[model samples]
Target: MLESLWAEMPDRFRTIDLESNALDTDDLTAFLTDPRGPGFRIRFGQLPADMDREMAWCCWRIAELGGRVPVGVLRSLIRWLAATVEDHPELSGSLMRAAPREWERSIAAAYARRNGSLPGRFWQENVGSTLRRCYEILWAAYDQRPWWRREVWDPTLDPRIPLRPHEPLGNHAVYFQQLEPLWLRIAIQWYFKVSLETGQLTWSTVAGPQRTALQVFADWIAGHDPVPPPWLREDPAGIRAFMLDFLSHVRGLITQSGPNKGKPLSPQRVNTLVTCLETFYAFMTDHRETAAQVLDEAGWLRLGPYHAMLWRHGEKGRRTRVVRERRQEVIDDTAFSQIMSNVHLLGEPIEGGGLGDEQIMRILMLVARTGRRISEIRMLDREPLLPLDRLCGSTGPADADGAFVAKLRYQQTKIEQAPDTVLVDAEIVAIIDEQRRWADQHLGPRWAQGVTPKYLFLGHNMNRNADKPFPPSRINQTLAVFARRLDVRDSAGRLVDFNRTHRFRHTKATSLLNAGVPLHVVQRYMGHVSPTMTMEYAETLAETHQREFLRYHKVTADGRDLPVDTRDLYDMLELDKRTDRILPNGWCLLPPRQACDKGNACLTCDKFATDASFLPELKTQQHHTLQLIDERRQAFAARTGQEMSPDNVWLAGRTQEHDALGRIIDTLEQTGHRTDSDGRAVRGAGVAARTDALAAEHDEERRP
Candidate 1:
């Protein structure tokens, strides 16, 4: 790596001599006069006599560590390094010894001296980028410890994501050095234990907010007037006192950075701060012996039951509050239509107020059509589309034509055991195919062999091997700007906020349920680990429910069309919220204040009502009822050598139920609600006939 950087330098600059601590004056003169070096000597004269050699070394090291650097940036880097060592000699002798804060001050002072104030753009382009590159190299070289043992863990090097190095380190690096020494030690060991030893979490989660939470706790501890001790290892009284003070301290704190700066910390933020401490203490207490041995301190054994438990029942209610406050809005049909119609604007040039992204529109299309999580879609493997027959070893379910169906095995980034593969229609497959072609055309040569790129969507910068998936934050930011520019709004005139891509997941799930798809099927489609989690997305719209309810004629006990107004019946039943009113085969139409005196004989009750949505349940119940009647009649005949009387009480009830079920089924079949075993509508002539009837009815309604 250094060879490429040293190619343009003279022989003396090619290698650092092990015996010489500093470059000789002649060597420095050769470098400054070299045609390839920064072609100016104005700043060179200001360099400190004792530290100029070290400053020159930084310039060499940065070039060696980073990609091609501009001469201007190299000049700025030299100036920054020289000024830093002159002003803060103790912090600047070597990049390896410099701390984050020291480097921070060095850059600020250097830029301030030259420009009066540091500008964000110039700082990033010149000083920040150059320093980060040099420091990254220095840290990699200085820290010879195993990753788990180091103060900073770079998740980009993790084998699970082989191309993480192609992405920026700021997003993936976890710094434990900011913590107090003791807490740092505990945190390092705990992170190692959970993330590597036990495999409790993947780095995606452990390296993110969890790491930030720990750092926040560390900062709080460092800010205490008198340094705080390990109260978790202290006696019960000390533990209690420490926790009370910590909680109060955390609650009263305000945000110090980002969009929420100067505002009070949210309840969610407070919970995270407290929860991290609790998690840390709980882990230490559970594995006290291991922690003690690892930290080389017997004090860890003092962790007790008091340390193991932190908050009492109901104490951490902010999580519940967060759930309660969460707005899972489904992008309504009008909004969805508006977005899709103008989706081409997303790929338009940025000068035209668009994202100039080629992949985002396709990505959003996949998410909407498949109901997949954005991460799952973004991290899709290159060959995500598998033949349905290959995945299941047979043709798919009868309703799905296998040739037009494919299994999309997305990267399961969140829940471990959740379904990773979902059966997708040809429409979704076409989108994936389009993206795959784009990746292949763009990234084929980047792969060493004929192998495909690892991810369907590749990162924009430094992704030579196509290892890193496109950044998720890019999608969010682009979506936000797009929505604002397009002024996309719903039917109610509220802005359709598409920034949270998860809302597409919610929208898809809700749409499926309202379209009469079964809950368990939706659960599998949405990759939900539990039906309850899937339920969270099941916000059924009343208009959809009413439309579906009114689509088919409802029949009563004797197979006659119900006389009541369907809209009034819908309101009277409160079908959306009242699950008790919803029965297996049909809805029980008894008023909320009225008792059902008819008991289980709902089929015989005049108040029972149902339509096409209940056709599947009705068919199953009718089949089962017929089986029972036949079995009982056969048993009576076998015992007495005579057929059971139709008037017998048990026989009469069975006949009535079987007859009632038969009548309901016949009525539904007549109205064209007949379906296959899978509940999919019979799709040939019956569908065309119903379509024509619906059109005619729609025309009549329009006229009236």
Candidate 2:
């Protein structure tokens, strides 16, 4: 082929020279690549002997004389360089693998993945349009992040979006860095700009966080160590200490910003942050060379063994979504109480206070009782923010019956299945109604009329004073003032917080969950997208936690309904009586309905052994009595990652206690049978009769 080219252009060997130039350029690029090519050298006769000597001089000379290189010519030259032998690799693999006529079918297949599957040419023709609409939904959600407003984004240009970014929210940099570049490339696309639309940049929706992180990262690329701003610094050995300091400083600010709105991060914001960052990595990775250096270093702290270290220590602390050793934190309980106690204008000097404080308190009380968000409380349009004007103008049984049944309604929530109207239980409803009337009398007749605001708790002083509801932040700030007055000293007057309005929400959620509100129900009420989030928001009540902790090792078994009282530390220890002071670690089964009374059961039952609630105490004796029970039950219907019952919450060891108990019950029923009707049954007339006789004999022996 080369000989034929030389023969055709024998005078100058123009064709041969051009072909060699393309080859040389390709070879030269491969060499500069550090890893270099399999065998590379700067041979004198090679094309582009030195990159600078060729293009630098040509570029400089062309620019000197007011000459402009036509984009078409530049494009052709670059395309030529890309195409030669190397260009084929960049060609779409999917396209190349398919038959020419099947190319459309192949593209359709890629798109069908998004819309599920569709047959034939229908998807080929419609998927591009459908995919655009799908992305727009995501784009709209992303626009809320606000960085999309920047000038760099072109609203008109449609860009290809990759997968989401990698979010190492609580993870370290080392591990994250390995995947970070890939994630960034997925999110950011600087490849080309589209100016077809008059709207904001479409890519901005998902790329905001990645873009910000990238820009921040770019600054660090210029230098290292103690990287500016977000590029945190710390000795690996002292990372725990550094993190503690940082969290201590930042918690207050983050809390105030409402990130921890009585729950973990709001699902929307969390999704946004995670999605945006993952996409950011996707974008970065597209340019492999740039991605390697950029993403790896960016989240350096987020990667490595340090993350596991932090994770192991993350759970013992207070607060949902607790990170690796954040500095000390506590609920702004004092301020919360102060604010509520002074809800009426009766007890405190109100700063932003007024009927508004009462309204806020009432709102808080509602959230506490009903476990709803502040927004849910305020935006409840059906229920007037305040209580009714009066209970009864005239008093009588009939007149009292005339009292208005105050109820909340029209759920303004993201969840559609959630119930709308909260039936205002008696006690709180009357108080709220009275407060509204009091406010009207003080603020004037038109006050209630003018309070057409979207939110009801505002008395002024908040950033987004839309329609007059006080901003949630300002209210929280006021609450902080109370917290400062209360936590006045952290363990040692090392004053920690001012106030946080979320205390009420947390307290309420905690109370409800502790009281046994199903986490799913709580999630719906709190407007959480997931139950995991519900658990985070609901501060674990010490009462419930203690109870659970005390009885964690014990559970009902053998088809017998275990009384919850078995969980009480007081019950387990028989603290009331010195008899059961030390519970033996090994299992001990109490006789059915045979509760030991340490004098507390007298009110409910005359006999001490009658009521199940009056258990004397756990004896400090070791008896692995129930071991066989757990073994059999857990053999089936087990949920543990380990062999344990998965039923036992604290069965962290390699024991699926649920299955164990299941196995035991199956065995007890199957083998315990004395010619019984069914083998699986736990009890039979023969067993019951015998057990009763034994119990009676024991009772007689123990009788005082």
Candidate 3:
């Protein structure tokens, strides 16, 4: 059997190159030397007459000896051996039995070596620490049978949440006592995959996203919101009734707003939500379908209607499109700029009490400039953003890789390339230097009361380890917000602003894009896996809005030199110049401002809303412009495939500008002087009035 098995094995493995492949070459030799290879040990050529038995015996022997070879390597060997020796069930079982223990030990060892200590491995050294708590997860140590649990009510429903002991709560209690550590580990692992893949360390994986969503859910539970799952019921009345009762308890933690004070559910949080929902839907669908098939054969829908009612629909039938329309005001550039200006940086005082504004600004600027995500930054070692010369190959700052590894070596970030890069613009470098000087002045060893944390930024409190860096969370928590408490108010004296440290980082990326940088370049600057990930910035273009309006309009030095494509590029503008929507009796769309310099009076000017019908035949040429827009949208979507949310109905159309076009139209309508009547030609007016109105209307409608 052994001879036949070896003969049947793929030729590639027969002459395996352990050195070339992702395998431990030395370890392979160690396994070959172990008793498992041949018990008493024999050359490969001189192997036993019964090679199959010899192989099985070798694996068992390794287990018996507590194999020196890594479990992963051993497992790999076993797979190769199993495939080669087809009739080796007993040997495979032994390898499987011992594989996990070895796997865990191997990872643990990596962390320990990297961190310089086992405990350091758990606290700060690597990405593994973020997920070190996951080591607590013992899959087999489940105390109870697998049970389906749902979100349960929490009695702490005041506007202010009350603290509770770990012993009591809802369904979370069991998880808290038995699985908290394990869940944390799982979250860490999940964060690891997503962060690495995204090219930006973020809690975008299910484990991390779920943690945030869970907190939001918990908050809702505490607040007593009761919105039922929409898919649970089909009838509008029933759904609404359930929603009304459940809305207070619905618990909305919309991460679309970005994370709050604590760690945010990564943007991948939505991806996780969809994936989990899809999985659940799949399982439930299959189960229900099978049950229904059985029930239908048995005439169950009528005879046992209750059974049918529980599932609501058949498996495939349950796949319904949810068309939820959102109503959000378009954020014009003026508003966006104001919001950003009001954002407090490191220098500003924390008006209501918080970290200094400049400090918060610096943090946000670093995070945003390098596209370092908020969560990733929280897990980072506090340090000044410095030139590469200062980062590595020098004693001034800890070596870049070494410092990052020690501070934020997460499983997700366990690579040569760190998600957070510390490149500083010349201006920002000046800011950082200023901050360091201030720190040296006020937080120096003599002025301060206790041993200061080694981190570049720190709170008043001393760090747990005087030698180690400050806790990422403690410093960030105190410094993340100052402007939010001070700024963001409406004329009515209500808070209309939503500010957070990460928001600045997000805004920085947005500003870069708006300043006319290429999407792909901006995506890279932000360290996003793809340009699409960067689209989540609030500056996303709507269907009616040109998110890159300035870029499109401004002729760059290169653009000016490039050969003009008069045929395709200017087709729309050309068409707009020749005609109007309909001829307006009053004036042309383009209004002259020869008399007055400032265009303020243009709002009440006489020529704003003229009818376009008077234009000879301009509207007929609109097809060209619309075509360009369509093409642009497709190109955008294709480039950033996942950038626009699938749920964004307007996003489905050409250009995000189109999505918020209503506002643009409002701007047109409110401008200049038009009759109080519907948008039309100002009939019977003098020739000047008619011409002026017509020109202004045409220009406004045609402005891209």
Candidate 4:
């Protein structure tokens, strides 16, 4: 049977025996001594007389898997298997009859004994691959399952995921071999493959956390008191009880491996496990016939509406809570500046205190400057930059500072209708230009062959056609390492967490809104499908407003100290939550329930208040009010041939506004250079200066 299977496979494998599953001593000698084969010239004369045929079969299997082990390494693996079977005697049949744990123990023993002529460490390292290949090939041949039903499902082998030649294989394989209950494993394989085909789950999700979630469930079920069999026996009620128990079990799980070994499973992780369980059962219940066909059992027909609705009631609420709790933290200006300044260090060698990749530096620069999601940046096309004139088909107006030079159309992976293009400045254009040159040079021969690279940031290894983009994992891992090495800290002195690149997106959105960019414009810039998603960043804006508001001491309209604490009033009035209370000059101190009867006479109303941050707008307002009084007085003189009376209603109101502005300006200027309670310079101190410069520029632009 093994001979027929070997003969039927693709010609990648070398033949062993045409008539028998096992090769004798002469057959093994002839195979190893053959000069036409993979040149295994070394030999082992001493062998277990009874197990020699099994050893020969193992070697032939290894060769079928394309492994070229040295003769010494091959002898060590065969000797270990022979020694293990001799000691146990239960595993004396074919190598595939033993479990993985048994093979692991024998391999450990071989390494310990320095089995064969190889050194102990060398044997320790080389024996694992030999045993693994032997087991993989034996199991594959024994089962003779279709590609999807096999232990490993490679996406590249699937016709659904478009293939590229010689590209580096990432986490592309979904392994079902370790999962328990043969029926459950086959069912998951069917659901996963079908999900990919139907566009329900992406290949990335299947190869990543979806597979992990399934594995967690399988491991849990294997250890359950009523271990799941190849065919489930539970009724709907029993299944519900079992599922609830599984949820609790998953909730109590502690990480047994990896960096977070001792920590409890996080809420996000627990949610993923529960959601996967819900989705799998729902799939199984919906397609009972398909499940039954895959499992080759009628037991799956028992799954019905009850099992399908297991997690529907409360799963969405739990997911929302987890999402809300995991809101991205916005990186502030100080920390962001420090990060950009030290970003070039990422290109230095790892041993030289850097992340050790020049590609990472350019990628990070683009991410920080563009505020694009990491996925968008990673999957950018080879030519993503277009000049404004070229994009619009006409020369667009350029500001004096020339801030807009081109438009960048990144990969719109998340939202279908969201805008993919963003106006970029010269700096961003330069970065894209630099990357384009680098990518073209990197794809040297391939570019010469007229094959255009698929991505701007090409994968570094095994991608001869430049078909694969740089991996997102590399960019994230590099950012983490870069942060740790630089010890980047926020204003609170806590280490800046760079693990989630989406924080950059949050920071960018917050900064734009604070700079007074309209909400609709910010929504478009973020490529959000709705304003609601962009409004999440408004919370950061509220924090900034409150911080600035409390930074300066406040005075009443009469220039007297406030009778109440400014912070207390800010909270009691809920000023941060009230848009109506926001004034062009400062803030409205009126209570929410109170009706404002003071039309345009806010200057005389007791509900009005001003702070140092409003000094620029106040000064501008004061100049306009005085200039208006003079202009009106002259216009009245020209019409009636006499100056307007001082008691005129309009003139009187203008005088009141002018006097009120003077009082506020005097009070603020007298309180100049004041700091907050922490003795830090107030954030609004520079606002006044920058606003004045902007106002002066506006006045110059309006000059006759």
Best by TM-score: 4
TM-score of candidate 3 against the unseen true structure = 0.35
Model 2 scores a TM of: 0.34
Cα lDDT, model 4, residue 135: 67
Which regions of candidate 2 deviate over 4 angstroms? 1-215, 218-276, 283-320, 323-339, 345-363, 378-421, 426-452, 458-468, 486-498, 513-524, 528-530, 534-704
For candidate 3, lDDT tens digit of each residue in 528-584? Answer: 665555665523433223222111221111111112222232333334544432222
Q: After superposition, how far is residue 673 of candidate 3 from its true place, in Å?
A: 9.8
TM value for model 1: 0.64
lDDT of each: 0.66, 0.36, 0.36, 0.68
- Tell me the deviation in Å of residue 219 in model 4: 3.0
- Clash number for each model: 0, 70, 66, 0
**Alpha-carbon RMSD of each model:** 14.8, 29.3, 25.0, 11.5
How far off is residue 252 in model 2, in Å?
20
Decide which is better by lDDT, 3 or 4: 4
Ranking by lDDT: 4, 1, 2, 3
Encode model 4's per-residue lDDT on 571-591: one tens digit a residue. 765735576666788656677
User: Which prediction has more favorable TM-score, 1 or 4?
Assistant: 4
Model 3 spans with C-alpha error above 4 angstroms: 1-175, 178-207, 211-274, 277-361, 365-372, 376-423, 437-455, 459-462, 466-485, 489-498, 535-539, 542-704
Query: Would you list the clashing residue pairs of candidate 1?
Result: none
